[model samples]
Target: MTSQGLSPSDIASVVDALRELRVRSLQSRRRINNPPRLPSRKALGAVVEELAAALFPHRLGADELDDEGIDFFVGYTLDKCFRVLEQQVRRELQFSAEQAGSPVDGIDERAENIVRAFVSRLPDIRVLLDSDIVAAYEGDPAALSVDEVLVCYPGISATLYHRIAHQLHRLGAPLTARVIAEIAHSNTGIDIHPGAQIGPSFFIDHGTGVVIGETAVIGQRVRLYQAVTLGAKRFPADENGVLIKGNARHPIVEDDVVIYAGATILGRITIGAGSTIGGNVWLTRSVPANSHVSQAQTRSEIFDGGAGI
Candidate 1:
């Protein structure tokens, strides 16, 4: 009720007027410049779907695939995938370049090269993906078959995409890598950056909320339960206290390591080979080889109150 201040109704009216002005300005700008069109995530997801069909036709598209028809099917799929993914990769690269205020030169050539290299490496990636399937089948008692794991398990699907996209990421095709990973993330709730180096025979059991940061190196035969985080403890800041990008801030899990659920091992530390990290543990320091980290054991509660409830 102060004389110097506006009433609540007046303030609300002023806010509404400003919102109307903003909407009008936005509509005018849209008419003038036409809203920028980005590629569809669903289209990118189709790329993964097609690539999966191409990679594992026998399993993913058994009814459609035959020994005699495989060559034609693969050829047709590759042709379509290359064309569609090329456009997506181009758009992603162009958008990223514009955001950075850089020129988007040689994008076509780079995308072509990326697609070619990725296709060529598909055979090898499939082998690794097979390893993952085998690992999952062997690890899980409920798994019906390798095909079941590949076709139905989100973890296996996410891992397959990660392995495929990791190659593109290493070949300096980050946009393509991002597209591939995003495809997996869309299909499955798992988010693994393609820049993370994961070795073969890796398994993600009940894989949800698993975050493996860029620059994290996971070795062969490593097993991760759900909610395991390989992240940075603290970021390294620049001169003005801004955090540096693309630094090696995540942990390294060596060969044959097992990280259980809800375990957070952070910050450039090495979990040496053949180690077993217990569930719900927080590890910030380096663990030596063949170490078994678990909670300190205590005597059973049966001794309390003469074994009564």
Candidate 2:
């Protein structure tokens, strides 16, 4: 074997195979780009970081900054972050237009509008996130301070990304929103679909293995623990035997509901307000408000010398 890697002929053969695989997978009429020109993940990550720091300037921003410096940092960071976000959103729109064989006219103006709408909603997002931070702080006894919850809690981290993603989803950048959601999921093991409508004051504790599916409607003051799955029990397919999209399959968790860890609530069931679901419960049907559902008690029998053989 030659130095540096595989021989040129072997490399050529592998490249040809990869090309064929790409063509087969994409099945698009458009020519394949070796690296598809999509939204930049790195750029989006940076934008999220900038947004986080901007939202909590004193805490997440650079250390040892005065009030004026904090203001300047927020202004500068938002300007730069929004510009990058616009570019990324433009890329998504461009890719979609090209894929649909549509005109790219007015794409720039549309991207600008979407970004502006997103920017306008920042205050509301921050408000929602503040509620989440407070919820996390109050819900966990071990949590020392609200600042600790804001800075260190995985649930709050996931909620921040989800809140950002939800705004982007509403602003017509679903692809970018999904990417941001996935970034949080990858980091925190919390899968929250951007399409899912979650209300304020939501708290997720020990947030690992939490899955909230698309179309899931979550109400305010809802608390969920680790390994909780609000997922679909079955798939409703089209006449062509293809799975139908956008069906309301996930659960609707009402306000003040507390779902414990390892609880799997499936289907389009309505979990009424103020309900408490015990750990490791596999629930399918709906439960009314103020209800507490738990697994059945285990019955044990001991056989002694006098007992039946």
Candidate 3:
């Protein structure tokens, strides 16, 4: 106001008037007492990336990383990670407890226990990811080397994140686990929920537009090509017609199943073990083990799609 040439007294009066007006307006307030907050998800993701890189130094962009170097790096990073993650987890849990009108007395202890459980399972998770890489290498004929698969393949990277995040999810750290998994999904076109239960030797070939819904159970040695969707058809609503969450509505791909390109398998139906689902097929029913499903030809067309008829 002074810059605009208003007098000092006039400016002060204007400010007081505005303040009084705001106070009066608050008399009709609809909501109140929202606190200033920090985004826990964003913070958790940043910490997770740091921890992941430390856990897998060479694979995650450490040029000078060796076997001995990796151990030191992991140890150092875990110390820092535990501090930050534990603080954030405790804070988030306290916030949730407060919001639910519950006591936050033991949130600190619970958060520590959760972090310890998650970090302790990292070794097993890494082993599972290695198996996934081996599975991808053995399944794909075009893959030249294991290094190529590990370095360039988005699917493997995403699978690694999924494995780690899934353990956190099982430990009941949903928000932190989701942030880690979504970080992978954003980099890779594969969106697998951390809550999904995936077995060993899972391979995703040319993974793009791959969506594995929450509650989906994928069995061992399952190979899925691009644009495959193992998802639910619809959500069941509650009595008030609002959709419920945490339902087991996704498909279950059994052991040794092969779903080819552009196949969409919807609902909670099970695709039996050793079944081969052909390309560009839509399936809702359960396919028996060792069954091959392909589109039936009604007329002898030119097969202009350039696929095997």
Candidate 4:
């Protein structure tokens, strides 16, 4: 206030208006006391970084570290990361329970269990991420090496967030998992849902504007280019006009399928194995195995600034 020479009464009036809005928002949700807060995205970002470093100690971790130093750094980082993660888990559990009108009597136990299960899946997740990294390197000729792909690719970063978020989604911390996924999305422009089931050796090249929906199931060795979407064509609503949830609404991409840039495959259809979907194609039906789908060939025409075509 002093820097800008603003009056204290002006600040107080603004705060009063904000509080009125907050109260109205809480009442609209029918929230009881609004439970204090949920997990913080900033905190989860730090946790993911620590987890990434733990998984790839040499690449994501400290570069100066030797083998023994690597081990120590991983151990220390994970210990720190887990503590914060567990607290976030507790917050999410508490918030969910409150929303459901349930008591948070055993949130601590549930949070600990979720974290324990998440920890158990780390090695497997790392193995899956390695497959993705290798796939990106081998699939792209411009890629110099797997290490470069791991360090440089947006797909790698997005999938790493996916790998962690997917596990957490399965482990019952979906809100936290979704927050982590959105962090990657906001940074990389690849919006892969935490609930999506992506298989091993998935490669997304030039992965900007990609959207894989919640119920999308991608198979092994699938490759996708920028601006591809596996989305739901329609929403099924109930009698009260509320959209039904948890249905398999997105596309099921089969093994070795390649979806190119600007392709939009919608509905609960299957893209068969070894198929190649060309750029800017809008598809809604299921295709057979080894099928090739593309947009219709356009006529060559020149359009002047006027009405000429």
Best by TM-score: 4
TM-score of 3: 0.82
Candidate 2 lDDT, tens digit per residue, 1-309? 656877899999999999899897666755655335799888898899889999998899889989778889998989998899999999999988887889999999999999989988889999999999999989999999999999999999999999999999988999999999999999999999999999999999998999999999999999999999999989998999999998999999999999999998889999999999989887877888998888541011112334321
lDDT tens digits, residues 1-309, model 1?
657888899999999999888778868755334344456677877887788888888887547677899978878987898888778767766766665769879988877877787778888988999898999999889999987888788899899889877887887667668877887877677789999999989899988888898889999989998999998888789999998999899999999999999888879999999999888777777878999886331113223456321
TM-scores of the candidates in the order shown: 0.82, 0.89, 0.82, 0.92
Regions more than 4 Å wrong, model 2 = 1-29, 33-36, 297-309
Show model 4 residue runs off by greater than 4 Å.
1-5, 30-34, 297-309
Please write out the lDDT profile of model 4 over residues 1-309, one tens digit for every residue. Answer: 347765899999999999999888888888637535789999999999999999999889977989768888988988898889999999999988877889889899999899988988899999999999999999999999999999899999999999999999999999999999999999899999999999999999999999999999999999999999999999999999999999999999999999999998889999999999999888877988999886762111112234221
Write model 3 residue lDDT over 1-309, tens digit each, in one string. Answer: 346687899999999999777766655552135442333767777786776676567877457877777778878888888888887767667666766779879888998998898888878877787789899999889899877898788888789878878887898677677877888888898999999999998899999898999999999989999999898988899999999999889999999999999888888899988999888787766777898888542112214456222
Error of 4 at 273 (Å): 0.7
Cα lDDT computed for each candidate against the true fold: 0.82, 0.90, 0.81, 0.91
What are the root-mean-square deviations of the candidates from the true structure over C-alphas? 9.1, 5.9, 7.0, 5.0
> Which portions of model 3 miss their true places by more than 4 Å?
1-41, 66-68, 297-309
For lDDT, candidate 2 versus 4, the one ahead is 4
Counted clashes in each candidate structure? 0, 0, 0, 0
- Clash pairs, candidate 3, are none
Instruction: Tell me how far the alpha carbon of residue 40 in candidate 2 is from the true structure, in angstroms, after superposition.
Output: 1.6
